[model samples]
Target chain A: MMEKYHIESYCRIKDQRISLNGATVFESAETNFLPFIKEAYKTLDTQYPKFFKMDALSKLALIASDLLLKNMTEKNIALVLSNRAASLDTDRRHQQSIEEADHYYPSPAVFVYTLPNICLGEISIKHRLFSENGFFVFEQFRADPLVDYADGLLKMQRAEKVLCGWMDLDNEKYDAFLYVVAKNGIFTHSKKKINQLYQTS
Target chain B: MNKVYLSYNNIVSGYGFDTAAAVEGIKKEDACLRQIHDKHLLPNHYCASKVASETLEEAYAQLRPKEAHTHLEKMLLVSLEKTIRASQLELTDRVGLIISTTKGNIDVLEPENPFPKSRAYLGQLGEKIRHFFGFQNEALVLSNACVSGVLAIAIAKRFILQGTYDEVFVVGGDLVTKFILSGFNAFQALSDEPCRPYDKNRSGINIGEVGTSVLVTKKTTHLAEESVVLLGEASCNDANHISGPSRTGEGLYRSIVAALAQSELNAGNIDCISAHGTATLFNDEMEAIAFNRSGLQNTPMNSLKGYFGHTLGASGLLETIIGMHSLHQNTLFASKGFQELGVSEPLNIIKKTTPKPIETFLKTASGFGGCNTAAIFKKVAEK
Candidate 1:
């Protein structure tokens, strides 16, 4: 029988609450994404101050990825993420910066975060992961494509592990689900398990 | 593993519709990029390739669709229809589709545009393309900055090789809109003149709009006369900077080395290179370092940025299509606008269109988010 890949650990952040392996690790009373994410970072008290510079999407992804990968020794983990908004939260900000001629002043810092994959870049820099990276865009949090791609990379020996995730931020409506896929763990890494964890957590 | 082949393909750009027209224009060293004075797209005069909506509509009118479509949608429709017609394949459940773009329908979000803002979502764009053709499987929308187009090919190749799909249709495009232009301008990445990749006097990059589609399949039937076999492909992140190329070209170098390893070949097997030469000082120099590090410094290489500028998401596959033609015709297209070697590393930049016995080529693209992808291909007919 073929060995199944396992969900080594999973993290979910939604509705101002974050969970790791189905247990609440962080919660915030703030409804807004910025405040909630800021609170999540403060609780960490990590020395990485570059977190203050990230856009909303990257911040959201960073929090989930940090919880999942902080202590792991693996550096060859590939990052495969999907989102629907695709940096739209920042896109709107960038559009507003240039829409009005009288107030037109497009800052490069704001413009740099206009692509969703920049979040993947953020996570990679923090984790020192120089492995494969892909940012897929979907309407909602679908687990099949993300899982399939990670599985392909692992089966092909492209990466020692894969950090598969779905991190999206568009105004107040946001979701972050991240997991590490490895050769063995407590739960099998499959589409059904991912969907269940996403829905229940 | 199933052998994946890149077969029928088409491109819709400022040059013209279809790959042949773009090839013809490139043969003449005519660039599609020109000075744009439209305040609607950008306030200042910028050199970028802007495909006219009317020209695309005219070409699309022949298709006879039921309703009006957005400019990007129309471009993809036209390009995909031609590619499907050439491939002569039906939309089957076993087949897949991948849509690649940095931004899709972003212009629809403009306050004046009639379309609802929801249309700006990448998933909505995927639904539009998928339903337009009634494909069975969901379209995989890849939005990894500029590497989306070439990486889409790699993703499709994986699906087909894994037996999840017998074949996959890949479409990619992005528009030259105020949204993209303003962003590039803010970065000071746009060049006043047509981009000259690897040239000592090169200023910067010129953004271009292009829509391209290609068919990747496991079967040998209905293949293009000049189809190529997918040898190896890999994607890597710099883990360095989100918006800047790595000074040491670490990510790109790793990606090329990994891809070559997958193909069971080395630098000597790469007859030519289709580099991700955005013509920016940092980007071109980074590529030169990476290529030289890969021992491809003497390989005949060229950046098509002069003929079409930097097409962003469309560049990887668009340039790969041109590379396909180069292999088929045994011709090395000139790296237009290149006058002098600008980078520290030495490269045999093809200065003129000439005949060469080519068998394999490499296509690379690097974008913001520290993303880089490399795909290697070999001429199938000769193999």
Candidate 2:
């Protein structure tokens, strides 16, 4: 007998606005990404001071995950986040630091964030998750593959829940749609429902 | 759940172009790490295992007409072509493609490059491979630092268990680009000499380049003689630091424990261990602690880094393919440059080549961002 999974909670952040479970959690007047994300972090009162030092992608993912996983204490959740641009924004910055002919000093801090999945590590550090985690790159938010992979994790008993979705950030524009999948919830675990939540706003 | 088998693998590295040639070099305890004098990477010459560009181009040209493919893409296509041809598996809707890479075509971002900037995106790289091979399914690209290679195998197995696809081809690759070299040099993690894992005199890691591929499928009829059963796998995060690994080796310990539990086998069943010994002070020390905690202190362990020079995303998969050969040939390749115990805990490192009847082995990898993965493989007898 296969056990059914459900989408327990979900949150989306884009265009300086945020929503959780189809309700408005935040909407900022500022269009710039740095200030808007910092305001969200401050508003949540997250104790993670490391959030300030992260790159834009990590900051965006951290805040979105913090909101979605709020009031839930389970740390064994699998993370299956995807992106299209990856850490290109930071890659550009890192490239600039060394591209100059005479002045070249590539900082390890910037180089560490070059990989897209470092956000998964940041989330793990913040939430103490020691389970299966993956960072994928796709052309768009492909809901079918995400749902299939997450469902497989649960079916194999590899994880009790999964924190899966898309988090793409480049330049000043960013978008994230993260959701938690578990055994029981308000929404049935299906490709249509996952796509619907992704297209909610 | 269906039993998945990993077979029909191919490796393209600095030593040789294919599996047989590379394995022959390994059996003789030969290493290909040469001094790289490229000024863009470092002012001082450093040792690295880089495949000759002409070699890659020549091999790739034999497979497909010379087009606008990037070096990394060429390597991947060549590696996959061999495995796919051997398996004779059709790229149908039931088959999936998974690629593991840390930086795909990152060189495309050079200041004076002719390629489009979009090629720098890994998703575009995945598209290139998909269209080249005519894969029916959207390719899955895993890019989680160094653990990306082995983690792809775990994900492929899960996809099969979920009944999404009956066959998944995993190809992992990374090149010795200036971007990678400069980044490692910035961290002072590049070794000027060939790396010596577990040696007290070890300095740092020697970055290598390679492309390795393996097919994971439920169909057992066309399995290769060297096929191995995908028994168990797991990944865990240390929740400690983003760049540095935990001093306690908590993530790696948990990952190995989970994999062992899933395989329903104790440490005693593992005949050997292909460890992720990057030859760095912290990484080698961390692996030592993890193996000790997992009750694998006495297992015959060896790090393939000395032979391959920590090929980044390709290291895990390349090493696993070598482990499969290790089990099939009843041989334990010596840990190339190990001289003495460097870490506090005791490890039974394989110091010399020995012939032993081994049935199962464990492949472990830990990377930047405190990610750790452990997978167990068993040699399947041919019908």
Candidate 3:
């Protein structure tokens, strides 16, 4: 028989607004990407100095994961995140560094984040998760596949918990809807529930 | 446990176009690394293996003439075309497609690129392959750094065990581009000549490009002559650093331990080891420590990077295909460009091509973001 999983917790950040379990946690009309993300990081009140060096996408994912994973201390967590742009925000910067032949100088710091999965690495480093993690790039927000993959991991005993969702950033526009999937929660693990949580803007 | 078999594999690399050509090339001890001197591509002449433009176009045209595709797409189509034909399996709803790549068509992001910017997204590349093949299910794109290739296989096996799909086709590839070249150059990880893995005087890596495809299915009735059963697999992140590997080789060591435990096999049972072996100083040392810790120090191991030059996401799958050939032919190929023992611990590195009754082998890969994957394969028994 197939095992059933549930959503233990959820968090979303659209633009500068933050929410947890469909309730608004913080809202700001700030349209600038840097200030908005910085303020959100400040609100967390944690001393993670490495947060400043991360790209916008990693920052967004780190913040969302920090909130959803609060008070949870499980090391066997798997990360399954997807996006539409897929590091294009950083790719452009890396591209600009070598766009001109006379002044070509690409920074290694920017080049490291060109792959979308680096954000997952950041989260794993912060939380000490050495479990299964995969990063998928989609044309849009895909709910069914996300649910199926996360559930499959849990069902196969590959992971005790899963941190999965859609986190995308491009051109100062960002949206992240991250949730924790575990063996206990109120909402049953299903595509419909995942879609509802993703759409609760 | 549900049995999973990887068969009907195909490869498109600098050596040749099909699996037969690649296997033959390896058997004949041919190194595909070529010295390239294009200023726009690299600052200095570098040894790398890249499929010629005309050859890619011709192979792609034979597969899909009317449809226009990117270079990466062309390589994938040509490779998958052969695998799909050999399998002769219908594209029913039970079949799935999984593409493994780190940067798909990233050259399109160049200022002078002709293609649209959207082509840079890996998902767009997946869509091209999916629509061209007319796969019944949505395609899965795994882009978790360098382990993306082998990790795709693990994911495909899980999907089958979970009863989601009966068969999954995995294709992995990456192309040599200025973007990739510049990035590696920034880290001073590019080698001027062919890379030498585990050599005391080894330098950095040489970036190569290739596309490889393999069909994973549960039904053994359609298994090819070279088919090997997937025994067990495991993936673990070091949780140490995003760019640098762990000095302790903790993640890879743990992965090997878990995979061996799951397969119910001991290190003594593994006939050979196909290591990641990027030829870099840190990577080779890290792998050495991991293998030593896992008690695989006595296993005959070789790194194919001397010929393939670290194909990134495609390296794991490409090297695994070579391992499949190794098990079938019972021949152990020499680790090209390896002159002497480099790392601290002693490993029985294969220095000469020798024939042996190979039965089981392990394929391991470690990549950026401190990700490592270990998979065990055993040759199938006759009925």
Candidate 4:
């Protein structure tokens, strides 16, 4: 059995505000996530020039995971994500290529991200987590299975620490939440203490 | 970690909404194939068995007004409505929601003139469902190819044991569209005749659509006592092929062995198996090898694709729900279109309806991208 881990950092994208650290970073969904990413990168004081301009969803996940990675070492970190739509932007592009019969078929580059789990692949490459990875989608977001999946990974010793949450971007309303979980003695973060971290908010 | 039981499960497939209806239709051994006569779509290239109208209409009538209009929306909303209502749960209750699907709202992406935006689709369908129920804690979605539904259940069990959420609602669904149909056609995997899983003359798969929901909880209430409990589950990447399963069934074998180990049960303990018989040659052959390697060769197994065609993402939950229904009813539905053994490895596939005391069962699926999952369920004594 794996020991329970509490959610330390909680963030929500609502009414154009990225609520985290008991403060509102941005007030518009269109621009809020990018600033949130910039702020996260600023906190870490490390910047990846390649990720400076990418899809908002991928950038958001990268910055968020960077913040999560700061809390602990990168040993045995896993990335698991859930989404209602896989990559709508990429899908839209692929659909366009397919529709344009006269032109060449869509490149595999764009076609690959059309699958939802590709984001996990992106996060894995960014974090260097070559271990266990998976993506699940349903009509709506649910937590029981995600928690169960994370715990299973821990119990199986597949990953010592996991970055798990939901990252969804379709039209304009993009939202993502993530938490880090590890063994009892592997890190200093306490499940109970972490629960209190959210209490002040 | 405490063991979280899968209390109640149900589905709305082409055959019907509930298990009784699906099983009854299966017992009759009816093939619900229909001709592709719609002028808007290609003709004669594709055919499928669809769920009856009454079942869907009845499901629609029961849904809340806000959830009943759209096609994909209605499929998910109605299934969840019945799932919650059957479980006797309040919408405000603290529970996790796990939605599993592949190509959700892909139909919304149609109309080539102006491409539809994905965010609007998510808000109208995905967020709408969350806000409708007020699930304030955590709502996650899983879209891992075709194994999404089965993976959803495995994740729910993990969360409950870790004490993330007391309960979870696992919903899986997808609507059929020209986009998917054409894609499958491109892959050359659609069978004109009714699909025959493990048959010597097996063709390809008949793509179908379905929606299924199961309420899983850690609380062992009386209702749970009367339901099937999920014992164990495991998932493994073939790492062998992207579009096809390994001929040796390496990943599938590992997944089955892991699941059996997690449940602390040997191969002999399993009473039956719900094979992922997509009717494709490579898929059936690989699954047969995996079963043989896992010592499940003799277990009476069957595939429900003959009854509902291939529901893709919903197949995992839909099949598991049907498996639970078999335990409760003590009647094993035969593989609808099975005739002769096809694969090299021999499997004991049920040809006729059989009544036996089913204590435990296994449900397995293999999808594109080298993904495979196996789940174990145990029948419990009704309290």
Model 3 residue B58 lDDT? 82
RMSD per model, one decimal: 1.1, 1.1, 1.1, 6.7
Candidate 1 per-residue C-alpha lDDT over B1-383 given as tens digits, one digit per residue, 9 for 90 to 100: 56899999998999889899998888888889897787877788789887788889899999888876899999999999999998889898998999989889999878898888999999999989898889999889998898888899999999887667899999999988898888888888888788899999998889898899999999987689889999999998899999889999999999999999999999998999988888888998899999988999999999999988888778888998999989998999999999999998899999999988899999999999898999999999753
Per-model B-chain TM-score: 0.98, 0.98, 0.99, 0.93
- State which candidate, 2 or 4, has the greater DockQ: 2
The candidates, ranked best first by DockQ, are 1, 2, 3, 4
Q: List the residue pairs that clash in candidate 1.
A: none
lDDT of 2: 0.90
Residue runs of model 1 more than 4 Å from their true location after superposition: none
Index of the highest-DockQ prediction: 1
TM-score of chain B of 4: 0.93
Model 3 chain A, TM-score vs. native? 0.97
Residue B198 lDDT (model 4)? 92
- DockQ score, prediction 1: 0.85
Candidate 4, after superposition: displacement of residue B298 in Å?
1.6
Q: Give the per-residue lDDT of model 2 (tens digit) for A51-147.
A: 8899999999999999977678877799999999888989988888777759788889999999998999999888888877799999888998899
Which prediction has more favorable DockQ, 1 or 2? 1
Model number with the top lDDT: 2
Which residue pairs collide in model 2, if any? Answer: none
lDDT of 3 by residue, B1-383 (tens): 78999999999999889978877887777888888898887677777889888988888877745667888889989999889999999999999899999998999988888899889888889999999989988788889888998899988988888778999999999998999889998999988888999998898899999999999999989788899998989899999998998998988998899899989999999999999888888999999999999999999999999888989889889998899999999999888889899999888889888999999999999888778899999998856
